[model samples]
Target: MPHSNSPMTEVLVAADCWRNEPDAEAVIQRAITAAAGNVDADVAGADLAIMLTDDAGIRTLNGNWRGIDKPTNVLSFPALQPTGARSDDDAPHMLGDIAIAYETMRREADDEGKPFDHHLSHLAVHGFLHLIGYDHESDADAGAMEALEQEILAQLGIPDPYGNREGMD
Candidate 1:
């Protein structure tokens, strides 16, 4: 495993969107807990800024950063040193950032019939994992990642996202 020169994981969460939901803080903390547990890492003194923004902001970000020109669910920019980059011995490493689109998240929750908190928690954990270099680009990779996600969510008291016997629709 690659570790930043720092001793903890940093989370920054910013919410610029309308939130009818009142438990964003708790949701974010739950995510942080799940992420930290999964990696067996601790969070050092850090700043986690979560933004609750609309599709416009997300779309702009997606276009500028990812070249996708679309509003996606979440995006993570990891500040972890590049694959072979050296760590600065003195400063705490900065774990980049995670951005989530609020509307999309809510829509997904409604569509899936999963509680909003559960869906948000899942995304938060997922984003944090990405910050630590986890990805699901291939079928096998997705299976592994999803399994870990399921376990983490379960630990957080979320139902099995894939426990249904039929399979994903």
Candidate 2:
């Protein structure tokens, strides 16, 4: 088991339509740990929905929530307001929702010539950061976020997911 400064995070995963993947819960737990390490916030709980459907399902969700019809690798619906404000005052704080497209992630990993575990870890960490109000809309912002991702991935024993040709086999 990974050592966590805080107690176990209630990371609820709903594989509504994914397939051909083993140990979804374990993968999710690793992601949560990565997230917790990067941020100083407490991850009391999270509600993540993993859909293994085609682009159409993701498109619908993207359009309805994000107002964009394109299918993305992962979409995070953070249960937090900007400035890291909490919406609830009496509860342990639901971290928010993350939706991942199984096909898209798998394809991206193969095309990028990276291992599935590495890519999945990257995406999960990315989504968790979003839940904690981390965004990369600029080069400087991207650099900071990417560096943080690299650090967390390192802690999890995953190589640089962005590509480390020198270390790859």
Candidate 3:
């Protein structure tokens, strides 16, 4: 049974490419649970969405939202909330939405010699952290965010994703 405070995760398959990994939804859910549980704030009972999209889908989003015009591994779109509680008490708090590109993730995993699930978990954790206001805009912030990602993935028995990068250790 899930804890009453556990955040709710909704996984949507926006592309057929995700069918290559039938366990994508479960992997994402596990990663999100681990991440939300370890975060400093109380994100319990919150609701978040994960879109398993393909390169073309992510490219459109990147072009529209980030103006990058290229497909990335994952993108996090956090919901904006006010300073006060919601007027509707019964509604769950909206955390944010995360979209992951299937082809990019697969290629990255293959290149890194990591299992597909492990890479998926890492991406999900990274996106969840972004939704919670953790960013890598500066060196200090990147270090902090990456450290937290390492810790969370470690809990899932995933080897350090950043270990291969020089000076990231």
Better of 1 and 3 by TM-score: 3
RMSD each, Å:
4.6, 4.4, 1.5
User: Which clashing pairs does model 3 show?
Assistant: none
TM-score of 1: 0.79
Q: Please provide, for model 1 over 1-169, each residue's C-alpha lDDT reduced to its tens digit, 9 standing for 90 to 100.
A: 2223222443333455555667875676766766665674444433344555567888988999889988988888777463655455645555667777888988988888899899888887787777777899998887887888889898889997766547565
- Local distance difference test, candidate 1: 0.70
Q: Candidate 3: which stretches are off by over 4 Å?
A: 1-5, 87-90, 167-169
Top lDDT prediction, candidate number: 3
Model 1: CA > 4 A from native: 1-16, 40-49, 80-89, 163-169
TM-score of each candidate structure, all chains considered together: 0.79, 0.78, 0.94
Which whole-number lDDT from 0 to 100 does residue 168 have in model 1? Answer: 67
Q: Tens digits of per-residue lDDT for model 2 on 17-134?
A: 4555676557767776666866777654544443334567777889999899788888887765336655666545456677777778888989888888778878878887876778
Give the backbone clash total of model 3.
Answer: 0
How do the residues 30-138 of candidate 3 rate in per-residue lDDT, one tens digit apiece?
Answer: 8888887788877887889999999999999999999899999999999987686566665778898999999999999999899999999999999999999999999
Instruction: Name the best candidate (by TM-score).
Output: 3
